[model samples]
Target: MTTTTRTIPAIADQIVLVTGGARGLGRAITEAFLREGARVVIDYVTSADAAAEIVAAHPGRAVAVRGDVRDRAQVEALFAAGREAFGAPVTTVVNNALADFSFNGDARAKADEIDFPAFAGQFASAVQGALHTVQAALPGFDEAGSGRVINVGTNLFQYPVVPYHDYTAAKAALLSLTRTFSADLGPRGVTVNMVSGGLLRTTDASAATPDAVFDAIAAGTPLLSVTTPAEFADAILFFASPWSRAITGQNLVVDGGLVKD
Candidate 1:
């Protein structure tokens, strides 16, 4: 089918859903969209208080819903909740949910020690979770005649600076899905892309990272700084905005120039 012809909506006109949006890097992404005046639906499996507080802060522009992205039924309900709150279908979706994981490389299982289940758990969160979200968002996209899918990724897949194997592998799979989904959905005016960031300086997931590791990453980067969630969120905004209308199936790294590719 030919992509329906329509004007790209401004960021303020978009209704956005961010999975795992109550805390950490996800919270940063949620705030970034709201700052642009977009109505936001914050999805969380926990962190209800945090999510509610965010919604309270934004008044009518933001709402929080609890759902697990790995489940299809819950994902559909998430969209319904968004529509109920905003009176519009979600025009953008940010699949940023991650399973329980920490960034302490010292505590990580080496290749020989890491089990298949570890990879499976990560895949469920990173790849399967994204799959459920995209599938659920498809109807809304078809209805609106356009949509944006921004998958949160990691720079480790490219650089493997610390090799958190399972987590990095799952993100890599998600990237492959990003390109394929773009090809399949582009005809319907949907764009699928990824924004990969390195170990964010202070996200909950990265809290376990030692100061020396952080400093080393900063030292290795051309900018001599570790990427922050807010900085990474800015790139996510770029993909969701009208300026990126023609771009799809691509990965943009926002790691302070640490990974050149």
Candidate 2:
């Protein structure tokens, strides 16, 4: 008898759908996937020009689609559009779209000051959006009998450094969904996971964060530097690869060791 290990599939063989992939951390993730030869669908609620540029840069390997993840119809249509453009089903889905937000700790609402509307809005974007995408992608997963779902998360739930209360709460719910979804989908040959990142050094959301804060974060981290969107994006790829076939319902934090968990 001989024993052999399964190797991860090449990115070129995977068709991926990335939400909010037109800019910020999503852009980095899309580019990384493209570089690895993956056929990518960049889903954007706005940022038309940015999405166009990414598609242009990648030529036939990438396409940009407009969709609001919070809207179930739009999400379904987005997946349809991807299939139409690529002539293949999307085997991987990355839920990286964030609700509109700025990382200005000074301007963030304190717990007592935060309102129900704020929480509701974040939940719509973080939790509801994931639900829409996952539900939309299920038929594809069923047809293929295999699929990958990588949800973008945040380290703030574990290490509430500045306590962006609403954002953190929504992501906490997303983590719960990650676990439950994995359990439900595991038997079907689908894997669900999360890649949580601390405040990235330079992204549109974090652009308002003070330079001093970035420096302080770098000094405290084991890596002695603030993590970049590109670095965080790389961690997302691991969850989507065949190497992670047996690993589901896990949250991998990519923040230069800022949070021990």
Question: Which candidate should be chosen as best, given lDDT against the real structure?
Answer: 1
The alpha-carbon RMSD values of the candidates against the true structure, listed in the order shown, are 1.3, 2.4
lDDT of 2 by residue, 110-167 (tens): 9889899999999999999999999999998777768899999999999988999999
TM-score of each model, in listed order: 0.98, 0.96
What is candidate 2's local distance difference test score? 0.92
**Candidate 1 residue lDDT tens string, 1-261:** 644565668899999999999999999999999999999999999899999999999999999999998888999999999999888899999999999999998999999899999999999999999999998999998888899999999988889988899999999999999999999988889999999999899999999999998999999989999998999999999999999999999999999999988
Error (Å) of candidate 1 at residue 18 is 0.2
- List where candidate 2 sits over 4 angstroms from the true fold: 1-8
